[model samples]
Target: MGNQTSVNRALTLINEGILSGVDSITLEQLAEKLGITSRYLRELFKTYVGASPKQYALYQQLMFAKQLLHQTTMPITEVAFAAGFNSVRRFNEAFAQELKLTPSAIRKQHAAGSMKVQANSINLKLSYRPPFNWAHMRAFYQLRAVDEMEWLGDNSYGRTITLGKVRGYFTAVHNSEQSCFDINIVFTDTDGLLQLKRIVSHIRRLLDLDADLIEVEARLSLLGNALPKINTGVRIPGVWSTFEAGCRAILGQQVSVEQAVKLLKLLTAHYGERVTVGGQEVLFFPSAEAISKAELTELKMPGLRKSALRALAVFVSECPDSDVEQWLKIKGIGPWTVNYVRLRGLSAPDCLLADDLVVKNQVLANISSDPQESELIDIIHAKDKAAIKSYYLEKSQLIGQAISPWGSYLTFQLWSQQ
Candidate 1:
């Protein structure tokens, strides 16, 4: 048991290093980041992940490069450099060796069958392991979507995105036949591969693209017959930026979800940046720098929530290497808010929103046999609320551990319940 735990820890650290240094990371630097020798990192990867660190990184680069080739009209030279290849010849050689096809051939094949979109946009097919519940995903985003920034239609979901100074929009429709999401991204700049990679990564996180649904289902099945069975492939929704998630969490502290969305819309409308994409106006979420410096006296929320928002913005803007502990340091940031940010913003899979009203109510409903659901809910909120909350938190933690690793998904499943 001890050895297995140690291996998991080591792999997690090494994976974090790789993810944080995808564009230009060397094996030695990755090893240093993991506080181990390069040889040990190589052995660990070979033993567990079945690939050397360099091989993994190279594969990622090649895949991203291939996506760019098939999705955009970028020149071969630009694609080569953008994909982090030292030269176009190296890129061409790598493509031939890895994919057994020339870059031009792949592009030509894509052109023959790719979806039509604006000339300035790019389209990529993002695949997921199957059994994904597209209806649940659509409803989840539609319910709490902020105005102007997000859109959820009959069979599609999309949002305007802001990554640093670059702003763009992406619309995605699920291709059930292929078990993939076909996303069209329209951006203002195509400067380098780094930005493109970041945008794709953000989208993957937002849409829960990389989840192994089979494994998640298997783990979650341990909690008896308690989950929302109809939506077995439900995914935990993710925010585009940590700052935006934090602000939304703070805004939602004491209000219902609908009220919180209203406040968020007001905040964004008052402070966010407006950009035009495909002849439509979209507002980007307000930046932390702007929030931290602005006088937000006009916001309709109470003083404490306003203060919390500013403090969160200041912390996120000033401390780039943020953690839950740093977030907890803010005056009004509680465990629920912090965990909400962790789950949705940072895409941490283990954090559960234990203190949320809906979570507590749903958990109580699952555990208790009381037919009077409303009566039980009133008891929870009436007197001895603190004790009841503590009991629910303890039970929820135990249940969460039983589900382990996939607690975020479990939380979403619980949320999906009536």
Candidate 2:
């Protein structure tokens, strides 16, 4: 068998690149990022994705262009450039050659159909595999909604975003009946169309719209009584950026969720930018530069956590491309913090947060409550922090092997049980 692990990691990097607006990424660039030769990368793609890297990139661009044409009022020229084409002539040629239709023909067909166009906003449908428990997803965000920067309605969630010179807000309304989210995005910048692909990719990650629930559920089903009755559509609800997620994770240490959100609100109000879009006011999360320089006296958390926050901000500011593993060098940041960021911030599929308090409690409650395992519970709750952590780590790895690569989902499943 081929190296499934390498293929999975490579695919994740590609998706992350696209989500970060690297639409014109070349095979050599991807290979360099993967630390592999182009020949092997091409073979991996050909075997797994059924296409060469070039073909796959082209397909993504065309699919994005077609969605824009079918769903939004963007002009064909803007659509071409937005989808990473240098010129409309080339876009038209490629579209016709690959899809057997011209850009104008597609636009005409879209106009002929039932199209709903809203002024100053782009509306699109994001699909997901069925059995999506949107209520659980909505409740998760609703509980931790930050003021001004995020808002949650009964059936929808909206948040302000700052994406490299583009400031905007998007509202994703869950349509359970249709198995998708009807998202409406409004941007302050006129050049926002250029960032549409990245924006859509972020929304997909944020809502976890691309997960195959059937496969995930089936794999997670083997854990038996260890996990609560598997919630049908538990997904990793993501943050806007890794930096934002890191900040949230640092602030959340040794605190309740409500207290963590209060700290976030205070930090946002102190340093985050405020803007009005479509006559509605919202706040963007603070930038690394802003937090790196601040004294953080406004936050009432422990001084060590504040230091950790600034250290993270400085690390992100200096080495924007550093891996999450590098964050451990900072004092007060540990495995649980890094794993939390990986699970929710990057949506990594294999992270098992064994050190998490809720996870530990849930696992102990289920396993320790058994009369035969009572002595094991006493050993776990013993005074030695290091030993306790090691025990949980070992236990989580055992469970993680059972679920294999879906440990991130397992983490959420345990959290959802609380």
> Which model scores highest in TM-score?
2
**lDDT string, candidate 2, 348-400, tens digits:** 77787877889888886777666666556678667666766677677777897
| Residue range 113-159, candidate 1, lDDT tens digits | 64444445777788888888888888878988977899988878999
- The residue pairs found clashing in candidate 2 are none
Task: State model 2's lDDT.
Answer: 0.82
RMSD of 1: 4.5
For model 2, the stretches where C-alpha displacement exceeds 4 angstroms are 1-23, 114-120, 369-391
Provide the lowest-lDDT 10-residue window in model 2.
15-24
Model 1 Cα shift for residue 162 (angstroms): 1.8
Best by lDDT: 2
What's the C-alpha lDDT at position 416 in model 1? 84
lDDT value, residue 356 of candidate 2: 86
lDDT, residue 47, model 2: 87
**Prediction RMSDs, each to the true structure:** 4.5, 2.9
